[model samples]
Target: MKNLFHSYFESFKGLRKEIWLLSLITLINRAGTMVIPFLSLYLTKNRGFSLEEVGWILTFFGLGSVTGSWLGGKLTDKIGHYRTMVISLLLSSVFFILLQFPSSFWAICLGIYLVMTVADIFRPAVFVAISAYSKPENRTRSITLIRLAINLGFSAGPAIGGLIIATAGYSGLFWVDGITCFLAGILLLKLLHPKRAKTEMEDTFIQAKSAMSDKPYLLFILAMVLFGFIFIQYFSTMPLYYSEYHKLNEMQIGLLLGLNGLLIFLFEMPLIKFLESRRHTATGYLILGTFLTGISFLAINLSDWAGILVVGMLLVTIGEMIGFPFSNSFALNRSDGKKRGSYMALYSISFSISHIFGHNSGMQLINRFGYEFTWYLMLGFALLACLLLFILKKILLRENV
Candidate 1:
């Protein structure tokens, strides 16, 4: 028992103090991730937008995300990660509050795009910070620790968000989301300050390359974009599935989504630790995890029973647990420490593209065809992603990256 506890503690032992504080900030920021999960439902049910309208709105948000990520990367390189993160957090908070005011469809669409543009600027900055703070050997565990924090916060967000929606409605969700973001900003302001380190300066001088010119990295990004398109449907369409198809309420949808986060929190850390102990390959995990992702969607499309949904959710969560952190670490390993922000930004673009093509096209498919058809599409594409990832892994190994 003592050995087990010791090993668990050791998993978190090597990360820098900044990593710990970043994890805390991540926890606080993600705990209020109420807006996005329920955005589709909010637009449809509250604002009475059509499915296509919601899809377009989400697509616009993705467009902004792409722009923000590119610009944020440059900003992180030119200015610094700390200042970039602080500005993104505070401005995004203001945007979140402003988002609550726009009622018309076009106005709401523009508002959402702006909000996402500002908010997503934080992604690459945070990644750069993680790389800057941790040693190379412990990088994956550091990324996993951040992910663990994110899932822990997600576990609370949906569960509490459900209650807020039930009693206080959509406006309350925005208020709470905005407030928490502001608090996270204030916390960062108090805790983190500017500093110049010799190691960073040396790294900057040693590796001053552009990620855009890296071919292997481009292929890796393509693979993530493909996989992400399929994986992202859980957020974009799954809540509507629970509410409309399975006849679950907002609170029930929240609970079900919360289950995904709770499972990750319980199992991800131990699983990653075990994998690290055994010296598992990132490729092996990525392939298996992607295959499991297909099976997850398959399990549910085959049945509508609530029990089946739980089983599917469990499978998806497990796949996510295995895939995402390793992918982040893989991106980190492939980049120069000096250009970590740029590489991470490029990697983040895959998700932005997924948001655009995934949610927008997904909603269109569901509206035109049916939910089962959409699931079938996701399952088929997930298998394709697995194959692509397998090939990409060989390429990466051959390139010795």
Candidate 2:
């Protein structure tokens, strides 16, 4: 045990104090969020809204998040990540807490749309801080550590949130989520601060040259955007799909999502290590993940194979575990010194874009076609993503190397 602890601390020798603080911030914030994975259920069951109406609401949230992410990237560059994160957290909390009082559909939609903007802004800034605070060599591990905290907290949050919603109303969960935000923001405020790299004092030429010549990195971002569309099933249409096809109860859906989070937490680290060891093959993992996620929807559509859905999610877990860190590290590795955050921010945009379009569009497909057909369409999307990943990987390789 002592040897293991020593090795762990040794591995973290250069990790800054602030990054660790941000990890705590992530845990607290995610623990509080308890809302996202189950948002579809709450809106449908509590609000007496149709799945299509939920789609419209999600579209707005996605749109707001896109705008917020853009603003966050700009603000992080202009003002500071710390300041931007704090304000966004406070604002989103206010909007979330307001859900307690309740309002008409239009009013709630407007409020949620607005609040999600700030909530979206909070993510990029925190990540920018993550990139900034860590040494380049350890950037991947640090980001993985942050992801671990997020998934760890996230893993527990859904099951708890399910219980809360079962016992209390949706409003209670909103209140709890809001309070968690405030707590996370407070921790970041207390523990984190800006620290410049010593290399910043030297010539900036090194970073610029690295970024300008990085073909693989640019291609990686494009692929990430495509995969984001497929992976977004967790939020978009998957919940409704599970509910409708599998006839899953709220508790069951909650357990499935909790299991999803748990898989991420359990395998993400070792997966990252393995993927990085064969970095050249990251595209394969990307392809593999998308195929699994896309095809799983079919399994969900066909038999009442909730078990298959779980298995598919485990594939997703494997894919995400392999691809996400590899992609982030690849991006950070190739980022131009001053534009690292910008690169990350742009990569971040695709995820929200997928959420905005993927769910609503998938719903439309489902409404028009049968359930199985709609999934085939999603499967087509995933195949398209794989093709893009392959093309980009080829370019990234021959372009620079």
Best by lDDT: 1
Clashing pairs in 2: none
Model 1 TM-score on a 0 to 1 scale:
0.86
Model 2, residue 119: what's the lDDT?
Answer: 85
Q: Determine which window of 10 residues in candidate 1 has minimal summed lDDT.
A: 196-205
Backbone-clash count (model 2): 0
Per-candidate TM-scores read 0.86, 0.80
For candidate 2, lDDT tens digit of each residue in 48-117? Answer: 7887787777777788888887777666655566777888878777877876565567776777677777
Per-residue error at 249 for model 1, in Å? Answer: 6.9
Worst 10 residues of 2 by lDDT: 197-206
Per-residue error at 88 for model 1, in Å?
Answer: 0.6
Candidate that scores best on TM-score: 1
Identify the runs in model 1 with alpha carbons over 4 angstroms from their true place: 1-10, 38-52, 158-175, 196-202, 238-256, 300-308, 366-376
Model 2 ranges off by over 4 Å = 1-16, 37-53, 99-102, 162-171, 196-222, 234-256, 279-310
lDDT of 1 by residue, 139-214 (tens): 8888888888887787778778989999999899998999999999989887765573224434554667868878
